[model samples]
Target chain A: MKMAILVIAMLVFANQTLFEQLKEKCELSKNEYLIVIFQTPGNCVKCFIEPMDLVELIKKNSLGINYKLMALVSVEREIELKVFQKENDWKHYMLVDDGNARKDLGAKGIAMMIILDSRGKIMAEFLPNQYDKNIEKAKKFVKSR
Target chain B: MKIILITFVTLTLISSNCTMKTQHILEYKPEKLQTQNLNKINIEPKGIIEIEEDENNIIQQITSVAIIGESNTLALINGKDLLFYDNTTGKFIKKIEATFEMTDLVAKSGRKPYIDSNYERRKVEVPYISTTNYTQNGIDGEIAQQFIKNFFMSLKNINNTFYSFGTIYCYYIGSSEKSIDNIPVLFVLNDELNIESYVVMDLNKNSHAIAYDFYINNYIYLSAPGMYKVPAFGGEFDSYPTAAKYDLEGNFIKSVSHMTNNYLLKGGLKNGWVYPRFIEVNNHIMIVYPEELAVFGENKKLFDLQNLPFKNDSGFVYYQDYLRYCRSKEMRPDIDVIARLFPIKIIDAFENENKFYPIILVWDKNKPMGFYYLIQEYTSDGKLLREVALDDEPENQIRQFAFNKYDKELVLFKKSKTSWTAEKWSLR
Candidate 1:
């Protein structure tokens, strides 16, 4: 009985790269950069506003055709995820994430942003405070070879 | 049993500590508008304007829409192409193409794609495409004459001989490797159909795009949601909502100020964070949300946040309790069923006679199976007027509304099965 319980726990908390998980969930395109925003209900206040700013940034810069901005929501059920997505008008730009994604990415901060290369390699990570800087750096990194 | 009991106690204590208890912001839940008031309302079926979607797909997208008040003229813009219609008759007046080309917005950085990929950084172009190559010849441009001629022809019998055309400003964004630029320009035509102001206003200094701009009392108030100050990322903490008043000729006036907390959560039966909607009511500026009601003084100082009572005790259930209930569902089995049916959002608001009618869009897991929208009206002093079932079809909900204060009527526009339709309802 003890061995079976241990096996179940290990399966539940199996280690996996956040990049791989996001790539699978968001259907990330090849040879294009990816910007993922890690969010949870605990940081719902800031979480609600950052997506709007990011959408504006993407639209103003005409970066939609160049890069993919995906939001990975953590620990939210189906109903909560739907509410968050519909409220934010993020139907096209978000994927529901399990609790493990945050743990895998080491993104414990509120509304942390992670930038990945075309092949799903972690390029840079940014906390909520460094939002504008994160956008600037991501744009530069995405555009650079 | 002892271990489970100890764990439950510890969890409850920890959860209590997690709750952030702020002063409870009040929300109003009014009873239905009295039948006397309801019977007083008169709805007149004026006319229906059918907006057709582009079949050929040549038009990039409909960027903006404007309705010329009283004149009954509607202008729909798709890229540089402008389509005009006589609202009363639903007649297509004319289509004018404006040329917009800003090639100076090319990204300079030699940013390439992945290794071995031959991707080059392309120049960012504004006014991406132009169909016509018409030029401005003189004082009254050639294209402007055609517009005025058609407009005058359509409104032949109007008594007011002298008509002042409305100036509709269009914004175009420009970007390069280093910075982003927003260019706002106003296009107006003279009586003879000439361009009065080729480019009335060009503002590129602000980092964030203007959230909203409207004309009221002879002054155009442009509001920026807030500054892009570092560390805040335009959140409620640092989002400074400031308005710049501009004259008709695009001259700058004084800056308007308002003391507001953008993150105020509307506490009621259906609780959520509410953003402020600013309006000019009876020569005074008022900021209102479904839950919050406040009038600004001459100095733009907001009134104290009022605490209003809820209709039922269920409405008094604070957000901290709600959050705790949602989080610790395993410990508390009774609330599990209730918490699962989470409300979606307050989708729309309509104001009439100092009363705000909020339309809440909620989704219930069992009965409805999909989104259910409800419209509830509340008085200025936090009294519930009436609640009505507005819409159930998620796709068909009121998106844009035009209020006719003179007629004491509210006009609602929504997407019908095939096209869009407008329905007008009397307010008085």
Candidate 2:
């Protein structure tokens, strides 16, 4: 009984550590599977299309998992932000981030995605200039989990 | 110095003798070897060399060249002047002065005059009751017009043949008002650079005709788009894209013609026009809608894309991915809708043997670096064999090319820095 309790406590502590790390970097608190897409003002339009599609696909499938999705946009102007929102149809979860967020997040370029665990721990990240490859990687990551 | 000169002279004598035909050179060689050791003697034979004098200097002002007929005679164009040269010897032959004016034929096939606000054809008064503000600019319109008259324009070449056609614009002084007419004339030249015929095509007055190709059966393919609703005196006609088959002499062949059967207009959209050129493969005449679609044969069947991995889906995926990545990029929504339906533009297509080589351009959906072409090879049954990306630059211009059917050789004529080069390659 003591051994079993010790193993469970260790697992919980590891999960908490992962959650803390993800929260520190992504500001995601839902402690579930979260996909945060980073977009820059000068990013290619082709970059954001796949993430939007993945969001739609996940929603349609009703995957029984805690998922928090948000787009970190560099543009500050409300009108410009709305235009970007309207263009991408990002009505639900959109966060305005500092322009240096891409550099801070270690993102190679725009259209980069950071996948986080339920405990706010980084699971996997995909950074392909091509959105097709990025979406394929995201789909495969979800399937593997 | 004398001994060295003698040795040089002896070597020249030996080389000249060896270069002669076997019958002429036999006299200089002994019938049998006098020495027993044949290994000690080294025999060298100078091979036959055919020399062709370079004629590029003479044709410095030449604009284009077309290798015609079985003899491969070159038909060179310099403005309104057409010069002929022997393809192998590079010898200049003769130059012919030509004029492209279709005015006489267009006036003869006249239409009804304009009346009221409606576009109804009605008889109008030939003479005006009063004349005022009459102004004349030299012989034609102005000095600018005179300079424009001398400008030369060449249209697409007839497929697999050296023949090409051009439109001739002519103006006539009517009883009351002046009128302009467009006439299409065919230039048929043979192997000797002799002008076989300069026949004016007997087509409709309001319709514009573009000659696509002249086939083996003497059938000429022409794109006469939106010709059914003929225009009246520079009036805009709704495009009803259509291609027709005519004889070598440009007479409409109803039996095999795509125009008579409504092949070009069969596409659901009425305004979806096609480029003038057509490729003949596997006995079928094929025309590409360039990145959008390809239609061929008498039935106008769509070429199957069974071999392409993603096929149509790949194009949409690219657009969606591109549009999402660049948040600031702006594009008309209608273009997105069209792209969702049809994603590619077929740029240039050629045929080698039974295989088809299509060059396609896929847009990046954003400005700056907008487009790139994908050169692909496919079988007649539409099996994709190979694909490569061709980056486009402003300086590198692909002017013209010819393909050898038997050897599978492609000779691409590229123009750069006011000079042209013929590059030959074998298709893998």
Candidate 3:
């Protein structure tokens, strides 16, 4: 009886660890905001925003904002995401979603940025720009909090 | 280090499944090979016009032949150059050059010219009109020139122009620099080579530059793949093979989404890959692709292999690997069985009292000579009323053949393997 109880306890602990691993890998936490960057699959060069711009924006504010950047890579392409990350120096997480990602996020064009709050509710969206206008709005929201 | 390892694991998991799916679709084995017997006919040789031999030892040839016009006038195009054969025997004619590189030619029978201003504003720095005057038997050239001019101008006024009972139009997507500002312009040119109208299609979303192709009846199809931002091993984000349709005046008629919900709902949206070959058959507009067929109608199918009957050809199976490899290398395969298999290669169509007949010329891969099997009045039930074997000799190949509606005869254009001269044939 004691041995069976011990095995059951270990199994439950293992399951908990697996759940934690998934949450860590996906960075899915109530405190973190999920920013989805949507794009069309091919011949969409101009729609893409430089990763450096995003990184600079995040670093400059010192607002203690927690967020994750996800790139919705289309399935049609045989893209190597690691190679993409290394070459572009994209330090954020990326996800592979095909056309569904566009429909789900209500994104009609490429290089669209949507900000989801900690509760997974959409807070705001930004189009193709330097985010000068968006940055001020985000600062106000952070200050209000 | 742990984060890097996690990223590596995630990428490997994602990429492996994609590779597997792609391979599964492309790597199917063929059952067997089949051959069909074709007819052969010899065309009389005319004098050589030009010839050049490639390293592969294959000869490139061009020729001009005379047609029995009112005064021995013939129409022919040689290696992108248009020439006319006007003589006593209707044998040899002089070369006629036009201002623009001729994309297509339509002969207007006894039609007069008319002008329109709708085309004037959209005309770029290039000349809006390109025409020439030619006449036989010492007839005045002024009448012919005016007739051609008025025909093009009047055609510009027609909202929908039909060519040989089929509507035709051209659509253009402006350059990337202009598209970003929502000023992307699309030009619609009708069958009579007149600018029908223009429209500015805006990319409402933050999009990559606009890239598109046209469907029959003026459908502007757009395909922008999402992989552009991702830094991958490939050179650039090649355009996807997605499509949509527009009206003659560049109005967005309908947009086609590439995805559908299945039981598992597993697949992603399709991308536009190649220039779409649009054809109107049985009043149905069908867009042909190597892997998929897009039929416009109530019953829509997705990635359905059975809809593409030409894929069953054994010759296609034989060349499948080489073609796929060439496609991977960004090269076009020479023998496109899909395009050639369908009746799309039919050069001309004519209607009799009770039936519509299509004159089709098909390529036979097994034959040593590049002969084309000419079928007169080819029925959809696979019946050939008249079979003419064209280009039997190994030294000569039939480049193109068409029915001269004006002359009421079959016109065969033949070129020699070693010479530039092309021979003309008229079968009564």
Residue-level lDDT of model 1, residues A10-127, one tens digit each, is 7755554657656666677786667777755324345546554665555576544456778777533343455445334566566667655655655443336666766866666655
- DockQ per candidate, 2 decimals: 0.03, 0.01, 0.01
TM-scores computed on chain B for all candidates? 0.48, 0.55, 0.39
lDDT of 1 at B372: 53
Q: What does the lDDT read for residue B335 in candidate 2?
A: 47
Best model per lDDT? 2
* CAPRI accuracy category, model 3: incorrect
Lowest lDDT sum, 10 consecutive residues, model 1 chain A, at A75-84
lDDT (tens digit, per residue) of candidate 3 on A77-117: 22434334432356666655544554455443333666666
Which scores better on TM-score, 2 or 3? 2
Better model by DockQ: candidate 1 vs candidate 3: 1
Docking class of 2: incorrect
Score each candidate by Cα lDDT: 0.43, 0.47, 0.37
Off by over 4 Å in 3: A1-145, B1-71, B86-91, B100-394, B405-408, B417-428
TM accuracy, model 2 = 0.44
Residue by residue across B339-403, what tens digits does model 3's lDDT show?
Answer: 34332244433322222344444444444643255444323232444444443555555554433
User: How well does candidate 2 reproduce the true complex, by DockQ?
Assistant: 0.01
Per-residue accuracy of model 1 over B314-338 as CA lDDT, tens digit each: 3234444554444443222223223
